[model samples]
Structure formats: structure tokens, C-alpha cells
Target: FASVVTAAGFSPNAHDPALFVHLSARGRTLLLLYVDDMIITGDDSEYIAFVKARLNEQFLMSDLGPLCYFLGIVVSSTSDGFSISQEKYIQDILARAALSDERTPMELNVNLRASDGELLSDPTRYRHLVGSLVYLAVTRPDISYPVHILSQFVSAPTSVHYSHLHVLRYLRGTISHRLFFPRSSSLQLQAYSDATWASDPSDRCSLSAYCAFLGGSLISWKTKKQTAVSRSSAEAELRAMALLTAEVTWLRWLLEDFGVSVTTPTTLLFDSTGAIDIARDPMKHELTKHIGVDASYVRAAMQDHVIALQYVPSELQLADFFTKARTRAHHRFHLSKLSVVDPP
Candidate 1:
């Protein structure tokens, strides 16, 4: 199959074997292969049709027209931008599960979340809820942090049902809210990385979170707990920056394959000045020798001009939405910055 695509003039992307890029005087095209399924996209309509015909000659193929539905996401384009949602999947689970507004009581929810407490009677139910929320995180970045915290207790079991219920209610109310990508959004890549020191009382592991943006629209974000404990907030911040820098490098490579070459240095925003100093100052490494690898990786990225580090104040740090729970005002502020449209 790879040979056949290669024969059709598409060069396999080094960053991802599943992706292929075709460049010519006519235009550019990108093909992503996933087992039996493939998505072909490009700016040249004629070349797109030709590629379809060319691929069809070697193997039977069906062109699915424009991408309206794929991998559970429902896409709709408008004059303003594109809106994508897992509306069908959300509705299906809501109908089958015990999360319906009519059935679930409002008072069951608690204001503050607790990581450890009395063991849950039904651990399987907690696990299932965690799994569902994990799947939902594919389109719902707003729930990523909470879901990440809840998942840690799934194996040992702890307070969970009410937390899951709260998330379900949010999904129910914002069923129509969808991810929006504006046509006029910038093509340049920008990213945010942040970490909270000693956030987890149970293990003392720090929480690291980062989000990538394609112009104004968000393309990727993650919430994770560091495997090794950091001695200070600066160490945690550097580790988080290291993770995000690697992600940005991969994304840049992926975009280049898609024919959207990012010529300018990618912006990596963080709230930690100590991290910035550690990555920029060679002498600072003597003080941060324990985190040598992560510090060095970031420093090399800066030296090579792959990324430029900027210090955003903690209050304005958008990645804060992923590392810790926030007030309603803060949540909306970060949500809007990510270009998500909430349902009224």
C-alpha cells in the first residue's frame, strides 16, 4: 500500500509514517492512512480528484466527498468557521447511562473535589465513568483536568460518582457547544506550558498542562502528572516546558508535511521566569543539574530558534485551566482564548 501511494507521487512524512505529502506546480496534497480508512485533503480540487482516481486504479476506493463525519466527530462549515462536535456520541451515552437531568439529582454534587476519601462501593462504576470521560476528552478540553484527577483513583477507588455526575451535567447543558476553527485563523503555531508544584497531596507529584494553538484556534492540549517529583516549582516548570517543546516540534513537522510550513519560531508561553532563566542561562544549569536533560532540551530548542520563550503572568496564563480547577470567570476566560463556542 505504501509503494502504491509512493507511485502516485506522495512522499511519506518522516514525522509520521501514516502521512504522505505531494507537492507540484499544480498544488499540494496530504494523505493520512489509518488501517482501512484514509483521509485525503488539499488545496487543489483537480489534483484531489486525480489522486482519488489514481488510488482507485490500484485498489478499490470510495471517495467520501467532503469531510462531514469521521471518527465520531460531526463537522459543519459556515461562512465564519468550522464547528465540530461529538453530538451523536454524547447523546447516545446520555440516553443509555444514568446521567440524564431528569433522573440525576442536582444536590448529589459537591462544590470542592476530594482526591482520597471513603472507598467507593462500586469501583467498576467509577472505572467506567472515568473511561467515558477520557473518551469525551477528545473534544472536551474543558473537562480534561478534572477527568485527569478522577482517573488516578479509578484503580484504588475513592470519591467519584458525584464528580462524574457534575461533568455529565456540564455536558448535558452544553450539548450544542462545539469546537470552532475560524477560516481567518492564523496558520502560525503558538503554545502554552504550565505546571503546579506539589498539586497532588496523595503522591506529591506536580501537575503539568500545555495547549497548542494554530493561530487563534486551539489544536492540542494535555493534562498530566509528572512521573518524578520535582524539588522546586522551577524544576516542575522546566519539565513541563520540555514536554511542550517536543510536542511543538512534532506538530511543526506534521504541519510542514501538510504543506502548511511554519517558517517563524514557534512561541512557547509559560508563567515561570525561573524556567526561562534556567533554559536560557548556561550557568543556571549548575543549580539545576538534577533536571539536566529537560533543561538542556529546552535550551537547545531556544538556541536553534525552534521556539521562543515568553513569560506570561500567572493570572493571564491560559494553561492554568488544565493544571488546576478554577472559578467560573477564569474558566470562561481561558475557554474563550481557545476559541471554543459554548451553547447558551
Candidate 2:
């Protein structure tokens, strides 16, 4: 029964022992859980009673009415839908960072150019600062590129590197930000991907970036160095697309398992027209002959209608933030595109 429901479309993982249930009804097909407790939803009261009776017979059970708190999250009923937030968690992070005061967060600025117009010298303290800023990227994706770049010098940092620590000081003023999951959007899957060519000064290796969204809300994003070196900007961009294609495939599988049906050829946004053209054209041109095997697989998938690649202008590419440094204005603009806003 579990296998059939799961295979056909049901998430037993949702009812897993980790989540506690607070409310359930047979008539409405509503179910909630926290840890081992469960609240089922449906129109049939008798079915709900039967489930309760069965559970009672199998294990000791107590019926709790309405849910105030489950696990570490607080739940409140509303007319539209439920909202979740980690208020306690937010306070704890602030207290741990010793940033209880200073209401407004400093503007995020990671581009720390030297006063003399030279690349700043690296220092050991730079690593520590970069480490802190990297963790802070959980809430501020804007600084991901600069943080990643500064991290490469951990083994040997210079004075110029220490200068980058100022971004951490900036974060000290803004640790309270949190991700908001609004109840006001349809549940649709959308994705965007971008890459920067030869952004690393030392290795000249390009960086790959991708962002995935559900109903216009930023859900997942990543910034990482490419595993293999590519010869051209087009190749790097194709590599990023392949990675994005793989992610979308996995996400589609997971969604299908949860009873969500997405149409074939899901739209994916790409900033490089060269990459888009390479993906759309199945033939191996001179420029595309050396593309990695993974990228080739992605191009094949695009041609097969597994995904559709759409061209996005450079300025509109949110993944641009993931692959390169940007000014404060551009950083804020990308954050806005991700729908992240400072707490009121």
C-alpha cells in the first residue's frame, strides 16, 4: 500500500516520524504532523476515527486538539494558508553573533578593491573573514562570488585579503534576514542558469551558477568552480546548462513523486545565446566538439524536449551574481530578483 501510494504519487516522507502532526480531517484531505504525531485531513470522520483507533491499538496515543507548537516551529491558522518562520532560530543566531543591537543591516559590499587601485594583498585574517561571510551567504546570496573568490586564498592570505573582511563587518550589521515563503503564488517550477568566463585570476577556470524557483520564490541556488577546464565562454556556459539540466531532472522526479505534474519541455533561462544555440543545435560544430560529456548529455536532453532553453539578457540573469563580483547596486538588484527583502 505504501509503495503503491508512493509510486503512484504520495509522500510518506512527509508523514515521517521526524514531523509531528497537529490537525487532520477526513472530509478536507488535510493532514499535519510534527515528529511522530499526525493530524489527518479528509471528509470522512469515520475514516479518521478508524485511523485513530488503529494507531491507538498499535501504540499508546493521546489526542491533542489544534496545534500551537510542533517540534521547533509555531503554527497558526489563517484564512488563506499556513506560514512558517524560525523566530527563535533567528534570535539565537543574532545572540550568538553578539549582534543584538544595530537595527539596520549594513549594505552588502564584497568588492574590496585596494585604495591604490591594485589587487589587495592577501592575509591570514582574510580567510577567517571569508569563512564568516561564506556562512552568512545562507541569507545573503549577493556576496557568494566575492566570498568564493576570497576563499581560494585561505592557505595564504595577504593584507589585501584582510581588507575583504569588511564584508563580514557589514554582515555583522545584517544577520537577522530570513527566507520568506509566501502563500500567494501558484506552485510552478522555473529555473535560471549563468556562468562567468575565466573569473579566477589564478587558474582562469570559469565558475558555474544556477538558481531554481518554485512559483516565483527562490528555493535553491549554487555557485561552484567547474570540475573541468573549458576552452571558450560558450563551453563554460554549456557546462552550466548541463548542470542545470541535471538539477531540473531530479527536481521533476521529486515533484512527480509528490503528485505534481509538470509539462514536458520545462522552461530554463540562460544568459548566453551561444550556450543556448549550442544546446538547441544537435550537431557537433567546431566550437562544441570539446564540450564535456555531461554538457553533451544536457544538449541531447534539450533537443529531446526534456527541457527548453530560453535566452535571458545579461542584466536580467539572476545567476550572474553567483559567478562574478558586482557593485552594491547590482547586488541589491539581483537580491530583489530573488524576491529577498530585508525584514521590516
Candidate 3:
């Protein structure tokens, strides 16, 4: 069978293969491979071990336990599914900010923003708050937008920036919030990315926002400043789509590594139709030829079957929560949509 399989052009793989068979006393099972990992499940562990032994005879391998950590996320199993977080990371940031004493979970006062009326003579306090909030955003997506906003003025933060520090302090009062990942859902990937063009008063560059989902739960996200200036809102959005596309490509490849097959045409949602059109239309005309190479590269990747792009309305775009400043109500709304909920 090995020779026959090899003759059929399916050679033994040390990493992973497109397909393999598991022969059992009762029946035979099939195994599929992505890039380097394989997902195998059966009713019988003994039979699974037999299959593993046969595969090991042909290649080198290591047996690890169930999936726990990946891409900096820490996962712990619950009766329902899994609890994921960077709680230790959050703790460290709190201590650094001199707020460890405040970690006892408590309801945050939205009124803390009123403290802006009081001026801090030392600007270092503002910088310290921004730094701590930035670190906290790793597990607390609810605070990412607020942190990004405060971080922008860290260089010469005024009483206004200091006022915003109350937002971070308020958030610090709620660090127990976390994102939960239950195992009951199907394995599907969806992504959304958006941008606010020339949002900064100093630099004209746009801000990029992206969110990725594994099934119904968000698994990854980002909100960052664009590296270059975008000539228009469309261009800013295109740049964001490009960034999201790159992330989708890497994620798909990683999923493939785990032997999980993802159908082609991975859907990526963008809020700007112009950006979507830019990604779909390969023609490099005057309006887009000047677009930064980074964005162009993302478009090219989308065209090459790396991922697919779709347009979403700005109002429905969750990525917007990451890229721009919002009022308290909208901030809570978007953060809740991302599934960053209060902890018990």
C-alpha cells in the first residue's frame, strides 16, 4: 500500500500530507492534512494510536496534548469549551502603571473623564497611563480604541489627554473582562478591516482596523496607524483591506498547518466599496497606481486566491471600533459586539 500510494504520487510526509488512511479492526478512517498539522478524531483511542504508529513508522513526529496556546493567546478548558485570555499580561501592565492596588474587580465610573478639568503639572503621568493602557489592550479589546486615542498625544499630552486618563483608569476598574471561546461552533473564518483616513491632527496617515473570527468568536484583531499617507478615504480603506488580507493569508496557512481544510474564497469584509473595487479590479490606473506598494501587494494577494473581499456598510463594520475615537455609548456598543463582556 505504501508503494502503491507513493506510486500514486502521494509520498510519505514528515510534516503533513494531503490525505492518509487509518485502518481499524472495525473500519478504515481517512485523515486530511493542511500545511504541517493533522486533525484526527475517532471513537477509539486504541485505533487512533495504531494509526499514529503506522504513520510514525514512515516519519518522525511528536505528540502534544490538546490545543492550548497559539499566537500569544492562552487557552484553558472549561466544561463548556475554553476560556482564552492574556490575564497575566494585563496584571503586569497594571503593576507598572501603579494601579495593581485597584485590580479588585469593580464597576467603573464613567464620570472619571470629568477629571480632565484638573491639570497635572507633570506630563509623565499621562505617558505612563498611555503606556499601561496600550499594554492592557492586548486582552481588553474594549480599551484598544481609547488607548490608541490617548497614545497619539503622549508626546505632549495636555490636560485634555490627562482627562482621558480617567477612561483608562475606569477601564482599569474593569480589567476582569475577557473573551470566551466555546467549542460548540463550526470552524469558519471571517474577517473585517476598516480605516479612518487622515484622522490624526499631526500626521495625515490613516488608522487601520482588523478583526478575525473563528466560528462565531473573535480570535484576533488589531488597530494601528497606517505607515503612509493615503490620498483619499478610498485609499485609506484600501490600505486597511490590504493589511487584513495579509493577516488572512497567514491565518489560512496556519489553519492549513493544523490539517484543517478551509475552503477557498475566504471572505474578507471591507467597509468601502471603492476599496473593494480597487482590490478586485487588477487594472492599475491613475487613481490607484500611486497607492503605496504595501496596499498594492495586498490587492495582488487577494487577486491570487489568497483571500476574497466583500463590502460592508460602515455602520455595521466592527473594525470601525478599533480605528477611530467614539463616544462612550458607541465604544461600549462596539466592544460588546466584539464579545468583550464583563466578567462574573
- Per-prediction TM-score: 0.89, 0.67, 0.67
**Model 1, runs deviating above 4 Å:** 57-60, 98-124, 158-165
Query: 253-287, model 2: which lDDT tens digit per residue?
Result: 65654446877677899878887777766664545
Summarize candidate 3's per-residue lDDT along 26-79 as a digit string, tens digits.
544445555545545544566667656766776676666565654445667777
Best by TM-score: 1
Summarize candidate 1's per-residue lDDT along 129-173 as a digit string, tens digits: 668878877887887887786776667676643454566766776
Which ten contiguous residues of candidate 1 have the minimum total lDDT? 102-111
Query: How many clashes (backbone N, Cα, C below 3 Å) per candidate?
Result: 0, 30, 4
Q: How many backbone clashes does candidate 2 have?
A: 30
**Which residue pairs does candidate 3 place in steric collision?**
34-259, 35-256, 36-257, 37-257
Error of 3 at 140 (Å): 1.0
RMSD of each: 3.4, 6.9, 8.6
* Total clashes in model 1, counting residue pairs 3 or more apart in sequence or in different chains: 0
Please give the distance, in angstroms, between residue 191's alpha carbon in candidate 1 and its true position after superposition: 1.2
- Judged by whole-model lDDT over C-alpha atoms, candidate 3 comes out at 0.67
TM-score of 2: 0.67
